[model samples]
Target: MTTQNDAASALLDTSSQPTNLRIAGDWTLANYKALKAQTEALVGHYDGNTSVDLSQLGALDTAGASLLVELLGAQRLGQLAETATHLPAASRALLQTVYCSLQDFCVPEKQPEQSTGVQVLARIGSAVDTLWQDTKALLGFIGLILETLVRVLLHPKRWRMTSVVAHIEQTGLNAAPIVGLLTFLVGAVVAFLGATVLASFGATIFTVDLVAFSFLREFAVLLTAILMAGRTASAFTAQIGSMKANEEIDAIRTLGLDPVEMLVLPRVLALLIALPLLTFLAMLCGIVGGGVVCAVSLDISPAMFISLLQSDIGVQHFLVGLVKAPFFAFLIAAIGCLEGFKVSGSAESVGAHTTSSVVQSIFVVIVLDAAAALFFMEMGW
Candidate 1:
């Protein structure tokens, strides 16, 4: 019998047909490094048929039992059953426990190598699949919103007037100053560029018409929608996402309340009312800014700028721009709420979906604006 101070050792006897492997000494964590190296070396010399003799093992523990199991493959445990019966009760129990624990151990299969071209194609396929899934999800969400809107319309009592008013204050009234300021600055820049370009051809007088036409027909609505996509959409996502993360949305549903009617409809209605007003404000500020730039840089008086705009630009341009506002507002609000509903119960999920809402809303607004422009051009509007 070996004491606790004796290091673990294994001896192999290959004189017989099936080799005998003898284990002795303190087979505990204290001698783990030496046991590990010795076990690994012994693995090459043994096979499934080898008979293990653990009867002489001293100071056996879980760690040493695990190494012994590794030296004698777990699959070969049956061959050592009779040998284990001759071991001390403690050593036998340790070996039995380790063997049973490692019985389910399996080597992971290696992935096959792929060529660079194949890998690139695989990534492209995955991206396309993801895009398709996103499109389907968005369409499904739009359908759900439409259904909820119809239900709310049928039930006048379901109209969340207070919530709608609050959102209008949040998404519309609070946003007006920044919207006006940004458009005003953009208008000044457009006027400066137009004045510079037109002066080269001795057509500086047309700069007023350029700014008015661009702002009234496209820039005003497009800029307002993009701003809302970033500002309002992200805000909507964060608001609803927080509610979801806090389990408040779940609690609402548990009480038999439709979250769509309570949360989404109010925001949508607010944006529908607000965007057109904001677009009108943007158009007014932009035109005012352009007129200021014209008066200062092109030697054109405010009177002359107004006269030029009245004579050259049509009312149809402003109408065309304002008509797209409601559509842009609906989509931005829908995307924001949809992404918010997607948020799982985590702060990280709320942040991720909020960012996704902004990106998707911006992308959709731009694409729809471009499509509308093409359609109007084709119709000769």
Candidate 2:
């Protein structure tokens, strides 16, 4: 049997030989060499295998760890009991994590089986069920919003008066110029078309009636709604989607603020108030454009155009346009806010919802307009 002194000396001699411990980070090679020399001498005095103390190591890196991993055969020695109990928990944990990652890099995991027809159908069914559940959730969300609105109406002190007023101004006043310009252009086109057709039939005087009827009864409201759908709807969706992506909505909730109250309510109320006003302004600009066309092109004169419009078009035309305005307003606002709330907190989601908001609003407005037209026609309007 070897004497303890001889064994210790042999162990010390073996350990004292410089062996690389592939470590990395702010340590010089000379520092690593010195540490290895000291560690080797200590290890040689004891058992041939011993845990190296890294607790006092001021710095380390992957280069150093890679060397250590190679020396220790991390697979075989990573979990061995510590010879030194004073090793830092941080250093040990770091080493273990690095070792595990290295193992993963060396070996890829097995893949799951590919789906068959039956499995694909099963997945689709599950997806449908999930979608149905989400639909119910979205409806419930809208209900909660309406309930909040009712509660606020019942308790005025709970409402933000300044915000509501500001929203109205934005939805109404800021939108006025675009609404006006679009309607004016539409009216000019309509008047030109009517003049060309009527002039052929020697009925050029009827151009005023055509302009008045189309603009007041249909074009103004429809164009205004579409504009709002494109402008305000996309803006609302993009704004809310950004907030969702940044986790600002979560922060608001944590702060006990209802995002619906802060974000959706103002927009909805603003649209409800603004759309009718915009419609009326659109009609005015359209008539003005028609008058200009008649004056220049048809020699009908602005006074004659206004007189004919007044005599031929009844209050019913204005009433119909205004009636559609509020409905379209509510539709645009609701769809925009709904799509915004649907955003999934990703960059792609923001763009998708913004597009969806505009598309949905336009579809709804057109559908509603068609239904309204059918109703008006049936009533012999």
Candidate 3:
């Protein structure tokens, strides 16, 4: 209550058999530090026989009242406030309030430590729950995409040819050079390594068969899909996420437009058409690269490499790789667009969801490819 610079004092007389604790001076915030120090110095005098005299106590505020309650202890606060006829009504009320509040306060209990096994189990359970949720989301999105696709297909006028063509240029044509270059380099490496290992057994010529079978059956589509996942998927997520963050998506919805149709369909259709073409291009590029390496390193002419591939590699190998393209493309495009729609209207949300899209697309492509490969192998394809 008082703003005066008067330092509060708590005096104790330990000379008598019973301690006498006296409080005096302005007990406001400004004197809190001094008063605290004084009380702390006389803490040893707190015993059952101690008697408090607050008659000389000056102005009091909540902060000082709190300190007084602490010095008197909760057990004696109520009784002292009631008996202290010299203390002002406001001061006594404040002391009682602080004392009651402090008595009711409780510190939260610390959690017990878990055993290693318990921690591990908790982590596994959490992972399973997350996986289940993700699976449900992906499946639901897929159904939504399928429904929209069917509706569009039924209405020829609803076809987004311009958007589809534009997206194809962006996702496929623009991507061809990098795809070709990577597959060519990887094919060369595969051919060279195969020749080196085969030479030990005097079968280096069979390197052509190794490269042909590997690239046509696995490398071409797998590599193309993985690249698209990282490159094209991230682009789709970022573009859609940016649009969503800018409220363009909401505007589209308000205008009676389906965002999935306006934004997602073109991208999905374009990828569907583009990925198969890219996979085919990848196959041709890979074989040529292997042929080049064979012509240079093994002294096997290009014609000879072609002849070997024609005889040793069957059409089924090519079909096996190309068949996986549509599935991969669908998943990659869907996952990318799905993540974009999930952005929470922030730059950081856009970034996090973009990264998540890439990871999910790549993982799905690889897993589906593996399962397809296993099915083919089991069926003697």
Candidate 4:
């Protein structure tokens, strides 16, 4: 046993040819602190041809072997296996093992700097790739929902009527006040802006037609869908995401229950039933708001406003907006549930996916609405 005062040490003899370095004493944890400092100081002095003589080294351990390997470099340490065959069997074997393990090691190369234009192009390419992946995933999720829906329809006994009703109340009934209020305010603002602009051309009386046309054809349904996207979609993601995080979804699968049918179907059915009804309510509230604004600001009587609305704005405009509700509902529900299923058993994942669900649902609704409007216009509908 080497005493603390006689701890491990290394002697570098540059006076000798090939710069012979001798290591002696117990190279174990008890002497590691002193050994480490001595070994590190000697490392920079040694070259590839430097000879390491470990014949006198005593009581070697993994810690000491690693320190010696670090000092000699793995290649030089490997050469010692044959040249210093007089070393203890355990020490020589440990050195060889460490050297072999480190033989093929390499430092990672630094990334090259990219020009601004190249960076911008790279970012664009990455965004496009991500969008493509998301589109494929969404399409796959939609297919799963459709398949589950078909299975449920075929076996009417699997219908979750109670869950559907509860979700309808949550998504539709609970969401009505905010949706109605937002659309009403928007309608009032549109009416005020219309009256102000038209008054310049002495066409203030046309403000009623402006409000009716805009709300019936675009604002009511668009605002309602956007509201549902933000509110209902986030709710769906959080609810389902929590289930996923808790492994309740996994347990459902283990019991031979389809998570899509039990969880997703009810939400989808509820939204389908709720969105059209909500769109109609929004349209009525918005028109009423516009009518109120006309009476108050433009001095148009209620009867006159209604007469103008009835005479100028056709029911076809109302039908056009209402027709988009089911599509928007399906997409919003699908996106929310899809994001929920993407949760990775973390609170952060739930929050992140919930936000994604809202953004995607709103984006899909707006894009689909624009496409629908263009199609209708092209067909002169």
Per lDDT, the best of the predicted structures is 3
Ranking by lDDT: 3, 4, 1, 2
Task: List candidate 4 segments past 4 Å from native.
Answer: 1-6, 12-20, 25-67, 79-97, 111-115
The list of candidate 3 runs beyond 4 A from truth reads 1-5, 9-30, 42-69, 72-105, 243-248
Give lDDT tens digits, candidate 1, residues 4-123. 224668888888768888888888999998888787777678777777677777888878877776877665653564466766776666666677767766788999999999999999
Give the winner by TM-score. Answer: 1
Alpha-carbon deviation at 96 in model 3, angstroms: 10
Q: Clash pairs of candidate 1?
A: none
Q: Give candidate 1's total backbone clashes.
A: 0
Q: Estimate each model's TM-score.
A: 0.88, 0.66, 0.81, 0.85
Q: Assess the local accuracy of residue 242 in candidate 2 as a C-alpha lDDT between 0 and 100.
A: 91
Cα lDDT of all candidates, in order? Answer: 0.88, 0.76, 0.90, 0.89
User: Distance from true position, residue 225, model 3, in Å?
Assistant: 0.8
Ranking by TM-score: 1, 4, 3, 2
Error of 3 at 233 (Å): 2.0
* Worst 10-residue lDDT window, candidate 1: 1-10
Any idea how many clashes model 4 has?
Answer: 0
Q: What is the Cα-based lDDT of residue 163 in candidate 2?
A: 81
In candidate 4, residue 51 scores what lDDT? 74
What is the TM-score (0 to 1) of candidate 1?
0.88
